[model samples]
Target: MVVQKSPQRAVLWGCGPQGSEVTVYVLGPTTQKKQTSVSNETGMWRVMLDPIEAGGPYNITAASTNPTNESVTLVDVLFGDVWLCSGQSNMYFQVSQIFNASKELALASKYPHVRIFMADLVQSETELPDLANVSIPWSVPNEKDLAPFSAVCWLFGRYLYQILKYPIGLVESCWGGSAVEAWSSPTALKKCGLDYMDEKLMGPHANSILWNSMIHPLLNMTIQGAIWYQGEANTNYHKDLYNCSFPAMIDDWRTAFHEGSGGQSAIDFPFGFVQLSTDIKNSTDDGFSDIRWHQTADFGFVPNFRMKKTFMAVAMDLPDSTSPFGTIHPRDKQDVAYRLTLGAQVVAYNHILTCNGPFPFLILPDKMYVYIIFDQELAVTPSKDIFEICCSASVSLCGPRSNWVSAPIKLWVQRTIQLSTELCPQSEEVAAVRYAWRDWPCDFKACPVYSAKTALPAPPFIINFQSSSGWKRRHIATDNYLSTEDDWQKMQNGFL
Candidate 1:
């Protein structure tokens, strides 16, 4: 029973007026007693479930008679995690884009635990409706079932379902050519100091008002997190708004969900985004490389935003050479899904991080502190045998026996090593330090056979080194070389 400004209440549907007393009553199958009133809150009431009444298939009816109406009944409902997946064409790309995605769909068809809720695409300029379409429940994936699903979303959902094995819910709100601005709340953009750019441009409703209406209503329904694969639309014209707009989109969604859901704060949601892919254009305007660099730098901009969460699957190296140039669509989406899953594997499952290749950069100190970082965890302990900081090119270091290179850093550790930089005591003054850096055949046992030797060539302004990796000798103009993170930042700032 629900009532306001009344001292008395009864479980009757027809409560006289707004300020009248109201009460609700329902006999429980296990309720042997005649009546019980357990608790009340802010003039509102709910049936308290005694231990015996907790588990039930019982009929519940609240009686209140008032023209204003006291309450409404909610049908069958389940509580669990829900994820909101949104983006542009890549996100809208369907499973059929992948080879035999139909088979994958068939396999998923057996599991009813996975639920997908799709919010129809709508753009709005006002406050969203209180509820979105829930007529659709979680469906089993089959050829017919998967037909209209986003391919990236399908694959990502499948991978998550496979691992979590829970009641996974997916809410896909996507439009192929939609920009980031379309999904933001008009007020949210204003908060970020953006002028309202609503399609109609009538007033302040330029944000993703529709997404708020259709999707925000489902918050507190519980959700794992989100996977975003967009920026194509925003970058289509080389808009740098992403530096502020993209992250704001995420934050706004979070704010709306939490607020609409009555400020439920238990969930510490994580968001994963896909860096714009390689097929993107390189035009001076909206160039893929430029956007990619922006996305890469974004990793550092958003606190706790990890590359592991936001993956940049390098499509530049994929072997599907038969691609249409200048076209936004890439036919091979299976690999796209696979790469995303690999990234998800790291974030959702706490998988070990390893270097995709020599990354971050290796720096040689005049004395001992050579700083280096691998993209992922080191598979092997840095040892003299595996990593040697060479000074003189003539001397070769092996195991602990080598007189030159210092001991390598150990596993799960990042640090600088100290070597006696007192010029190679053997002969010609030592020149440069050698990292696992090489070209052609890199033969680390754990290294994949297909791995190509990636070597850093001597720059015209850096000390010269001789190697078979097509590295040319160049004079050292300066001793300082930009590190990986540094270089990544410069590129992000458009300095490169």
Candidate 2:
């Protein structure tokens, strides 16, 4: 078993007889010892060890001074960073379900310092003081242990281990087909004005049940951060309330863990999550797209005002149609993990790098064209064709029945794209513009727009033009006119 270690200390804890004196000994590269007494009422004991280095293959021995004189010894122990991974079905997807399962399982032995633990799936009406069941205790990575564990969780920890070259401990607690409310605490729900319990909602998908059983029990364990892979179930129900409930849940978890661990866990720990991927091809439903936007609190990016110290991985470009589990369950988790790891390096480890793709920094529309300026250098594969412009001249008139026609790309230059407004009827005016606003926009990693440096896909977004003067004033203020022979020459010379 591996315990989470901070820069100066580590904690060891367990249950024992009431009022019994417990002694713990650490023997490895360095030696240390500590003693504590079990709580008379709660029968719980915790010992905070002295300062210790990160690397270890230590032996920990715990003995109690009770009548029974019971003792336990743990071998091959290490001190490192611990991370909790939880969410719905996508997070519950096993390692064997990913692409090239055989090859991944065979490579598990190479990461002996990375340990894993999985809590059993259960639910309760009230919060649990301790875990009722443990499916898999803390164990080093092996073919048997890696096959049944979460593929995304394993791959993420593996990537971090490779970069940090230290021990990593991952704990998995997730359920399939569970909604966001199921994992949210009552305090969080009440903050969102959704505290009332629905009796009809029961079982693994009910409100606050999974939080009580699965998450509450593990709050005592210190962790560096958390990563989530959910929101698919929320797309079917409570689709509009995600922006409120999701951020509330994240805040509540941070507070609970900080208090539960006696301030061992950071109050503002870094949080990372995977945005909802593609669902169906050629489907016009807006449920998946809505959830994706709400996942970031409608900001289309993380580390926003509502969600601080958070990072996100864009998965809209990855579409899986040949999975045995179904089209909804994508098999390529390698790319998802890789993208998430990049976010972690920047957010958690303070690494200096580009972690995200191009995002719209400014949208300027003129009489003949609309110029979309991105924050980063743009790279286009084939021609950009998924952009749509509203030609209704008013917000209320814009809908499926209105004039929302495809606006093709006319000119491409560094950090800017010229969208032709000629496709719209001359009688109508372009009122709004949106990009990749469908359930499934493109094939696997084939999205037309990307970052030239990072190769990450641009997230989908929509921009509205309230009035002609609003855009015209900004265009004149910024002085970003790009209709020149020099700009065209730069484009033709492959400078973008």
Candidate 3:
């Protein structure tokens, strides 16, 4: 088994005979041992071992002072950063189901220090103290053991190990086709006016059922952070409420883990999540796009005021129209994991790097041309045809869902793209501008806009503008004014 490794702490725990004394022996690099007695009431014992280095192929022995002198030994134990991986079907997608499965399986043996564990699919009406079952116990990576592991999780750990050169443990607790409410606790759901006991909620989609069984049981174990690949299920149910429920679930998990681990887990640990990828290439439903926006609390980027210590991996550019597992399940998980690792490097490890794509910070509408200014340098592909503008003579007639005309890129500079007003000649004015707004905006890695240096695809966004002496930015979803020129100046001065 693997014990979660923090900066200078590790926890080893188990159940034993009540009121019995348990002695633990650590035999590995920089040997250190601890002893603690089992609780008479709960028959449980935990030993907080001394600080140990990352690399470990250690052995641990637990001997109890019971009538029979019961003893157990754990072989090939490891100490490393354990990351919880959870979500719905996308996260449950197995390593064997991804592209180049055979090659990935063959390379599993190379990662001897990396370990994986998968929790059994179980649900309970109430929170559980311990896991009912474990599908795959802590095991080193190998062809047989790695095949069924979460693809995104494995790739993420592999990437991290290559950089940190330390042991990486991944715990996966996911259910296929499970809704976000299923993993969210009742306390979190209540914040969004959702009832776990609602008559319509039951089975895999029941509120808090999976959280009670799959997540609650593992709360005692300390973790470094988590990576999520969900939101596809939420696109179908309570899509509008996702912006509220998703952030609430994240906050609740962070608090629960910190308390459950007795403060071993950081209260504000870094979190990374994959934005909803594309589904149904031919369909025009706004469900996917809407969920994507809400995934980031409608802010179009993460690590904002609403969500702190978080990172996002945009996946709309990775669309798989044909797959045996269905178009919803994309086959290429390498890029997804790669993108997540980039964010983790910056957010979790405090590395200095460009982790996000260019975002539009300012938009100016001139007489005959409108200029869109980005936060970073531009890398415009063939052309910027993905951008669209709402062309309506009056703001009252301009709805978010209608009167959008393609605005081709007329001129491109260092960090700004110029568009001619003549493109929308049919209307007296352009009320709003949006980019990559469709469900499947482009083919895999073919998005027109990207970071010039990092190659990270620019996430989708919509910005509304009001006509006056000067343009005033408006929130896309809420239709509220964002700020005045003074606030924009503060943003430029790093006050926001």
Candidate with more favorable, higher lDDT: 1 or 3: 3
Tens-digit lDDT string for candidate 1 (1-496): 1110011111112213434344433343443122222223334332322222112223344445443545444222223345577787778776666557557667666745555656665555455433445333445455665667777777766666676564455777777777666667665566556655545532112356555555554543334467787777656432565666666666666666555444442223456666554442322232453454455443321223432243334332332334442335655666566656565566545676421222332333323233333333333333443234445544243211233343254323422233344434545333444332211112212321111232211100011233322221211223244444455344324311
lDDT per residue as tens, model 3, 1-496 = 6677647367677888788889999898768778999888877898877767677778899998864488888899888888999998889999999999999999999998888999999999888878999989989889998899999999999999999888899999999988889999988999998864658757888899999999998878888999998988887799999999999999999999888777888899889999989888766787888889889998899888899999999999998877799989999999999999999999999999988998887776644666777888979875556888877766666655777878778877667777766677653678777888878889989998898888899999877677644654543334455446775555434421
- Model 3 weakest lDDT span, ten residues long: 487-496
Name model 2 segments beyond 4 Å from true. 382-385, 395-403, 466-496
Angstrom error of the Cα, residue 386, model 2: value is: 1.7
Count clashing pairs, candidate 1: 33
The segments of candidate 1 whose C-alpha lies over 4 angstroms from its true place after superposition are 1-79, 131-138, 198-206, 265-268, 280-286, 296-327, 342-358, 361-496
The clash tally of candidate 2 reads 0
What's the TM-score of every candidate structure? Answer: 0.56, 0.92, 0.91
lDDT of 3 at 23: 93
TM-score of 1: 0.56
Predict model 1's lDDT versus the native: 0.45
